[model samples]
Target: MNRIALLAASAAGLAVYAIAPAHAAVLPTDATETVTSCGNSRLQAGLATRVCAEITGTTVEFYGRVGLAGPPSPGGPAPAPRELLTTLSVEVAGAAAPRTQFTSALFTASNLEVRGTADTVPCGSTVRATFGVASYPYAANPVVHEVTVTC
Candidate 1:
């Protein structure tokens, strides 16, 4: 479906989720990860999310994942994150804007994930590379990690 439709559906899901009490021995909170070469973890609603990108030789290897923040609750319905968007780009010398390499459609899952590799402009030099993701349900902001990777 389109983004507007997807967003509306997610909102409805949230409304349903709002009243479903978490099964808590202690409690669970959302854990999320942002743009990093190795990946970072931080989200809300007992979900954990991460994205990583690293350059090796002339290629960038990337990984993104979502999972339960803690052990499965006996009865709590964990929130599924919406992977709104993902993008990869590379800056070209003297170019007004970076060239787009990839973009993904919306994905919804408790175990959301993605992994792939893309060639950098070249292997001999440093290049400005970027990895980005826009997710829902607990993301404070969309990730837009830019880093210089040497091949």
Candidate 2:
């Protein structure tokens, strides 16, 4: 009878062990920022471009663009044509009223440059800005030249 009771106890322990949950290894969080050039299109003789910057471990995406502007064409031998002007608009993934959109006064016909700092980002957050430009009526397929800066 003692042998039978010992065998029953051993069977119950084995069953419990079989039904226990297994522990999984924890993965470290990624905090790197990834910048990508999403391509561009010609909009009424002006180029429209986009750059996407993603923050790791979160669903936040920073979308930036240099607004469309007409291509600079030479007037005549007397005076050269002035370069086009446009604004850059940057917005977070899901927020409103805190967006940053600045129109630059300095202009260029074939090249676009954007320079600024993002001060509204959270501390320890990785911020990156990508600037690009495309020349119209010159290149067959307007290719954007990109430069990325980390802040």
Candidate 3:
């Protein structure tokens, strides 16, 4: 009888352990402030001229919580890549507001030079460029804009 009781207790404990929540790799689900570019120019597209601005700053923010599969082996941390994924430029806008949608990852990091022409206005206008990984969402929406410099 005692043996049977011990076996049942062990089984129950095992069941509880299995049912309890086990820590899984937590992925970061948030947005972070990145770089900014300034300086814009007016250019002719087809019918009307367009204004393009450049923003300089840390545009890529880390997303997705990265950790070791198990506790750091031998007290050493697991290997994590320096760069996770490619950065996508959302839009270029004035007044620190992102006008374009951050949907496509079409563009890439350029040589910090102005190419196209912006038909809006010239430098001295407050322009903001927002970039981020499209997967993650912002929790608190940190301040992305600093000084409204010319660009």
Candidate 4:
């Protein structure tokens, strides 16, 4: 009986090991771009926003979210909480002009009506922009995101 239990345990362990992945999924590096949301407490008052990035080969796309607060009650001290209002997705493409050495490339999205700069670093790249809403009260100021990628 003891031998049978030991055999069962061994088989189970082997099965688990076999099912497990040999290695974790590695983030793309070569000619790839990544973007992330830089959360800000000041923007959290009546608005919420997030940024996301997708990279395929040498192309990179960015996404943004905008949120707004709900209405406040009559004579209430606090206003209603904020909620997601909309989302914006834009593809960033290099400009026609040559990029200066050690300077970031210029990218823009005419459809979304936004522009930003991207710079390469040792292991990855960083992006900084205001999502073209800096004048808006709820707009986040100079939102930044970074991702690791091979040059």
Candidate 5:
């Protein structure tokens, strides 16, 4: 009886070890959540939320939101679709341009549009922007990386 009990316990422990995962896990959000709202936030029926991301780079920042603003009434079906609002704001960090390096050009020039550029920018740093939906229409939620800015 004693031997049987010990065998059962060992087998149970082995089973548990076998079932356990070999590695630490990574969550979907960790890689998927970009600065963009649509790319970062989960979509549901008739939901509207805004997300803003700030990047310090010479490249342009394109913005968009995720999910449709929900239905009109609590009991009613979902409302009409909401369109994306996309825009770009230029960011600068240090030393006024014309003399400032690309990384330190925090002040907004002609195309760049941003407020409080002086306060937000740090000295001597370059910024580039990139954005996209990793999962796209399917919603895989991939990470957004830097893309070179054009003149």
Candidate 6:
């Protein structure tokens, strides 16, 4: 009877754990960003990260990605790549509030990405964005960039 009771409790615990909802991001999801041009990139510890920005109408979008910068060792076992945190920070010259988003917990496969946007920017307005990445515990890196695009 004790063995049966233990098994029943274990099954109930597993059911509750499986039914728990996952945490969702507060920011809007990206619409398939094509990182055609990368303004900044960092290669460190066999990992490569890139950050870019683009404008559509009055909205500005930012992107960040992390992947393997080099091949793994050909020794007995390959080292598993650690998780990287990606942050996209955007601020308009005249805007009151800055927009920022952080994506971690790893993206598809090996590459990781985090994206966000700043909206209502005027035509030919100067926008500042920073793309940052950190290893695991920390997320985000890189430099700041100023961009102006026609409406």
Q: Which tens-of-lDDT digit does each residue in 1-151 have in candidate 2?
A: 6999999999999998778433211122244654333434444224555554433343334443545354435663422333333333343324354334444343333344444343344433333333333333422222232222223
Provide the lDDT at 77 for model 3.
56
Per-model lDDT:
0.48, 0.40, 0.29, 0.37, 0.31, 0.60
lDDT of 6 by residue, 1-151 (tens): 6999999999999998778533211122234442233455676333576666665555667676667676656765555546656667888778767677766654333566666754656676666777776675544446465566454
TM-score-better candidate, 1 vs 4:
1
lDDT of 1 by residue, 26-60 (tens): 11111232223543564533346565555544454
Query: For each predicted model, how many residue pairs clash, with residues at least 3 apart or on different chains?
Result: 7, 0, 26, 2, 9, 5
Deviation in Å, model 1, residue 41 alpha carbon: 2.3
Better of 1 and 6 by lDDT: 6
Q: Which rank order by lDDT, best down to worst?
A: 6, 1, 2, 4, 5, 3
* lDDT of residue 121 for candidate 5: 30
Which residue pairs in model 4 clash with each other? Answer: 29-149, 29-150
Task: Return the TM-score for candidate 5, rounded to 2 decimals.
Answer: 0.23
Output the lDDT of residue 34, model 1. Answer: 26
Q: Write the per-residue lDDT of candidate 4 for residues 1-151, one digit (tens) a residue.
A: 6999999999999998788443221245455344233423224323433454455443444444444333446686653333222323222123233222121222121112122234333434332222322322454243333333334
The TM-score leader among the candidates is: 6
Between candidates 2 and 6, which one is better according to lDDT? 6
Residue 1 Cα positional deviation in candidate 4, in Å, after optimal superposition: 23
Q: Candidate 2 regions off by >4 Å?
A: 1-33, 44-81, 119-151
C-alpha lDDT of residue 98 in model 6: 68
For model 4, the stretches where C-alpha displacement exceeds 4 angstroms are 1-26, 29-45, 69-140
lDDT of model number 6: 0.60
- Ten contiguous residues with the weakest lDDT in model 5: 100-109
